[model samples]
Target: MAATYKAPLRDIRFVLHDVLDVSRISRLPGYEDATPDIFDAVLEEAAKMCENELFPLNRPGDEEGCTFENGVVRTPRGFKEAYATFIEGGWTALATHPEYGGQGLPKTLNFVVEEMICSANLAFGMYPGLSAGAYNAIAAHASDELKARYLPKLSDGTWSGTMCLTEPHCGTDLGLIRTKAVPADDGSFRITGTKIFISAGEHDLTENIIHLVLAKLPDAPEGTRGISLFLVPKFIPDANGAPAERNGVACGAIEHKMGIKASATCVLNFDDAVGWMVGKPHRGLQAMFTMMNVARLAVGMQGLGIGEAAYQGAVAYALDRTSGRALTGTKYPDRSADPIVVHPDVRRNLMTMRALNEGARALSYWIGTEIDVSHHHPDPAVRQEADDLVQLMTPIIKAFLTDLGFDNANRGVQIYGGHGYIREHGMEQYVRDARITQLYEGTNGIQAMDLVGRKLSAGMGRLLRRFFHPADAYIAAKKSDPALKELIGPFAKAFQRLQQATAGLAQKAMANPDEAGAAASPYLRMFALVALAFMWAKMAEVATVKIAAGEDVDFHQRKLKTARFFMEQVLPEHLAAFAVAMAGAKTVMAMADDEF
Candidate 1:
């Protein structure tokens, strides 16, 4: 079974150049030197890595998974080699700070490359992906001495990293975590607790594992405010930055379950391990969030990646597989039956997947660009605006992208029909692989709540104002553009509905504390549908102009048509969601507690 994935470079370039406008990105401080030649070279290398090293291992890794024995975790065969290849390519640190041995590429470029890696092998990508987050957190908050010691190895993939926040008893509720970090004489702490659902927690891909564990200190405040971050390693690095003696961190077990089988999801026991503080004492949760926000967006990329992969596979199958004749005519008369691609419903599925995937890519890259601008922009106001945009869009990226990713993956299975259900065809693998994306990374539901409850009204609707105002103006301006007018009109209507929902949630919150929580998830979905439609409309605008230029005709036409499909079929879901939001808290709270 050869792993199947088309790099979608044309589509990627379309998003980067025509849709999101990456040329403006080059003007940012560190990004000024990111030449087109360099961009092409980097993407070319990334395509080769995904098409060769990573994609080949995806299936085998899924089948073999990881093995745990005697406190050791062994990754699937060929994963170690594939991961080594990944490190050698310098992908692990592609977007890290240049001062710390990183390539310092624009984060949006990294977003494109990341989708390729994940589409090729999401499980393997997690190893380095999580490490990048750890690297970012350390770069952001750790002291200069600590950064000097760890950043180089992590950036180069001499060491890998893990976020050890979730425990068996507590996942979303950090307040309930029981992990303890006792301060030691040398200013280091002894961390002792069990952490579960830790991806890349224990793996053979790297020599040492840098565990960013969250724990409570003695005399620390109770709940989340008291939680602090510690840099606990599997084997402590010596002064020379080499793995020295073994640390007390050991794998209790590895989880066995659905999807991303190749990823090492470990239950780690840190028994009185020597740990160094990464950020301020009693601010561990806060510090870990820096890592979490990065991870959340990265996980959202997983959705985009898987969706793209599934769409690619489904399109191939649809073009090749023969089935019932087209209702209109016999498109393929020479064959036993017309190809599935001739069928309207099949086209609907593929277009839905394609439209959603492209919309997500554009939006994700846009958000990634904002992340770069947030960090590297010269003006503080520019940085702040970009940062605020990233914050507002984070939950949408996590929730909506994953939701559509899962749906698209399942739709791919449907496109394959009976064969898709079997393991050999590989469609089921995609379906399974995509499932966990919705569950982890704060869960799409939690992401929704964060969007409506925290992000929308957090600053008394100020953040929502920043996002919607520009969108409103764009919709108002694009009304006369015939190609985008229809798409933008519905999206604009949805946007107004979102504004109404936003105000409704605020009013409900004023009346009842629980009202916000009940309306949060649906409101998030309503907003995301509109946001993605906005992206599709933007793409349609770009596509319409590019098609007029007479370059890449088929690609631009597909973009225009898919954007049309999204407006026709997908954007309408928000109307129902808005209706649901209008229904309010009583439906959710009315359920009896003992009903379960």
Candidate 2:
């Protein structure tokens, strides 16, 4: 039987109410109406829709995928109907501002919704997910005129969106792009380019598809500096904001991908497409980053979502599938064979996934709350601090979560044994789907570089201060607290290794950048491990109090035990990562280019 998903509502509530006090979000400006009751109701409905409307489609959607012929793309069966229900329920506008038809909630809640969708149907989530990114970029940077025309529909989910960045010849190097944009007399531009790997680029889901395109203007300066952003729609809207004439942009072909088959990955041909400048000319990358950053964080949530789904599936398999008895004796004599859950090895895998998921969830969702605080806080210093943490953690969240997400999904297959290898159980599908998260949103390696090369050094190490100061302070304050005595020592040790790694990488990169590049991956992992350790220790503190108070004893006790496992078994892995990172770039860059 295929594994089914039941949303981790209890754990989610624990994070919201117990570990992190999200009611503070309501206290922020513009989110005064946001309350726990409302958030719970929203999440409850989202869970139902995901479980009922989306989960059933995951297996069949992977089977059917998407079909394209004659420039037309059709999604798997029931997708359009499901999307319609999504918007009708106001799921798309949950976190947007109220000004442009949004519900004016908070980004934190939207993040929870994002996870549910990804777990329920990742491929299906791509459509609305892209729209949300485009919405944020446009909302933050686009002109008021553009916002009036596009924001309402996007907020209402009447129109879908895509980011047209990567080209057939270029994926990471925007400087190598050949897309051209010519100024038109009517304050618009004629864009000609072919963008590849454009997710949700063309589909039968919405009335119009908005493409936030990146291209170079004629007579532009060299490299990415000369690039500009343009708003190009599949069908240009008329005066009444209705789909009028079809634009020149069309899907040339769709990639037959390894997974997320239900989502359209297209080769978008913008042949003199009518588009308008999004931000200042020659500043497209800056504006587009508004969307890219959101997408990157969303990708991290994609990892967490997939991990949670796979974890649940593995747990079900471990408890239900019977094999050999325990080494000592048979625990369940009623069964013909003992359940695999009796094995220590199986317990290890289960514990590993559980620890990673719970830790990542606590950390990621806290970051989500900080995102809201960053944007809504009244004090500039407070806002800057929140933003710094968000910026610093963004890469870690993207690379680390996706990395673990794939690992946990694969472990699902491992636990299921032979049944997991084939399509009957649907465990393999999670693996295939999760494989892309590591590659997309600026690949995990790219994320590492950005962390070390860009964010780590930003503002003379101000961003690092955001995370390190808080973590260091926590370690010092909790070292004597008996509640976290068992967890804090391991976390403090890991944190110190992270500090050593950071100083070493920063020093080496100053002499030869390649040294930093070589170790960025491990450094990022070490940083993530320590950060998650910090989260686990904090969760332990909260759980201890709750358990002492005898509130939700089972839940709080479970959290306390998971926190221990993370510190003892998972967090100590950072030592190896620190060693790998401090090894420098010698062996990594040793081989000659033509050694073969």
Best by TM-score: 2
Q: Candidate 1: global Cα-lDDT?
A: 0.87
Cα deviation of 230, candidate 1, in Å: 0.3
| C-alpha RMSD by candidate, in order | 1.4, 0.8
10 residues in a row with least lDDT, candidate 1: 1-10
Evaluate residue 254 in candidate 2 and report its C-alpha lDDT on the 0 to 100 scale.
95
For model 2, the run of ten residues with the poorest summed lDDT: 91-100
Where model 2 places Cα greater than 4 Å from the true spot, the runs are none
TM-score of each: 0.98, 0.99
Per-residue error for 47 in candidate 1, Å, reads 0.9
- Candidate 1 lDDT over 76-172, as tens digits, reads 9998888888888889878888888898888888888989988999998989998998998898888898899889989999899999988888889
Tens digits of per-residue lDDT, candidate 2, 10-94, equal: 9999999887899999999998988898889999999999999999999999999999999999999999999999999998888
